[model samples]
Target: MPAEEHPMIGVLLNGRTLRGIRRGSTQHEALQLYEHAAARLGCRICYFRLRDISLRRRQVKAIIPDGPVGRYVTRMIPIPSVIHNRAIHLTRRAQARLGRLHHLRYYIYNRHTRYSKWFIHQLLSKHPDIVPHLPETRQATPTAIHQMMERYDTLIIKPSNGSIGRGIMKLFKDGGRWHLQYRTAGMERTLRTRRGKRSKRRIRTRRWAVISFRSKLPAALKRLIRQRRFLVQQHIPLACYMERPFDLRVSVQKGDSGSWQVTGIVGKAAPAKLFLTNVAQGGTVYTLEHLLAANPSLHPERVRAEVERLALLIADHLDRHLPNLADLGLDIGITQLGFPMFIECNCRDLRYSFLEGGLWEEWAAVYYQPISYGQRIWLDRQVTSGTAN
Candidate 1:
């Protein structure tokens, strides 16, 4: 083994340049937290973009016992002690490349598996505590959608594989009519223009609806190689702040004691005229206390308890089923009755939410330093045996 590849304390973040990407605010927050944690732990951390780092499938397989099949099992990687997988948009080649490096003990805030998407849904479906918070939901299809439309006055169709609230649509029904509303590609405003006053004239300008026909989104997305399918969920008619919907983001990281902890909590309020509370759509984050206080109907303590419980539950569930996840950023929402619903569990790009004071201190103790040093011993033994043969 190379000297730099020694069993030293450090973290490897897997992704691209943080600035160029959309929805970078959350990414920047996470990167900063990881860097701070790495420093406090007396460890070095490096960032690698899976898209940039070239890898040959055959080469990665050569190091493992069952070859390519070992990826499904716990194997070792050629380099590094810990890997923080932050690759939000994974390419087919990148997925294959990372799968083979199982020996290095790559850590994810969420599980990266073929059924990872479905696993999230399963958690929501099984957990009675969180299920009541969710709106009426079902798998998406052409035939099943009409029933959803009938049940709910408004609905949302979202791409299962997407992130940062991209390719999400919000639908509304008025007078037995349906219209789609959404934010445009860029934050553009629609203003009525008139050179001079005309006698009772009407003008129509093209505007992107939050809810759009699947045909208008992109066919190129279908061409991208994927491990699984998409989902159609019931849109939660969120309690609004000035007529726009909002949601809460609770960031959770694994503590060094092999437990889950909530690092930060932020309530994301959507921009004016937008239904989604995604930060990419100019949403704002507020302190949990202030947010709950603003809405007197919600019980802040209960919501916090539920958030903490669900975070641990998801972390435990992922660790039980996948065993490789280190962190999870759960998107949760509150209904009028102060019920907490499960929006989604994002394992891919687990962003940090440090709304409270000294949030980094808590994060440093857990994520800054790795959880298990014992895994390294077994990895070394395997490498030694391979060399001996």
Candidate 2:
């Protein structure tokens, strides 16, 4: 089939150079996924950085493969009918550039903030069903921290824009003192003996140190608060697997029918003694079935049904606010009492958890669903133009 016969679909990426033919590049991986789906859906797909688009020419200099298992070639193709954004970060300049291409539609619309806990809390607060799942959260002011600490036995202080469990501090009152635990880049530990008993090891590091301090509020924590804004959330006692804290990751995507559906749900277990279950933070992924088996006391079917229902509801609700959202990766924590808690939502969700759990079919669905949605948009445009003519 000729490329001209199909509507063009542009995959917006982060980098300047295109490496669709080179293995391990964002363009390469995206091209590989889009190529198969484009063939089936009858679309011409190309990978282009945001700067590659030319409004004057009404075309994009994109990296496109010559053929299957062939070299990559650059071509000035007509501006895409739709764009599937996979860029992790979009600058103001890039946003202005994309804004110029107002005629093209987008699957994943805008870059969402990682500090969106408070934003989402406010959005979901209107609905009673979702409110219970939201933990008590507030802007990390001194007063807010004091209030939260007074209310809850344990509190979590994390950066408003943090990811991969970075800049997170778990605080709890142990007897008369407050204890803070957090992860850092690298730290040296030394064992000291006090009164003929081995004392708790002390850790020293120049950078963000993974250590615990017993005091009212450490100087480091105060510096952290003074440096940038943070969020103080009431920590929930999440269920555990083999003594490691675990949480459920529900992947929801808009299907070809334009309805939200749960694509995959897997459990992520943190290393022992760790508070976070982020896979990037040395956490392990487990199948839902495995998680259910580990906790036989809870009804597996009931939990699965409830989680799916909640995930769909969240996706639908968020869609009202984010109209162009094609998919979401929801981090939901199931408490020991079997209550579901919303941890966070990722607009540009990482799909490696699905792949790690041997869910290739579901992972593939993530790539293909956007293409199908884009194809529908293209077909609608053609129909509208034809009818006008």
TM-score of 1: 0.68
lDDT of 1 by residue, 300-357 (tens): 8988897777767766765666646666677888776666677877764334344322
Where's the lowest-lDDT run of ten residues in candidate 1?
58-67
Q: lDDT (0-100) at residue 213 of candidate 2?
A: 49
Candidate 2 local lDDT, 1-389, one digit each (tens): 55575676677776732553455455324446667777788776778876777777767788886775445778887767667777765467765665556534333343332326667777877778888888888988777887887898799898877777887888888776677777655666666687666667777663434444453567777778989978999898988889888998898876568788887888899888788888887789998788778887778888888889888888888888854677688999888877788888887677778777777787677778777766776666667663110
TM-score, one value per model: 0.68, 0.86
Clashing pairs in 2: none
Please name the candidate that would achieve the greatest TM-score relative to the true structure: 2
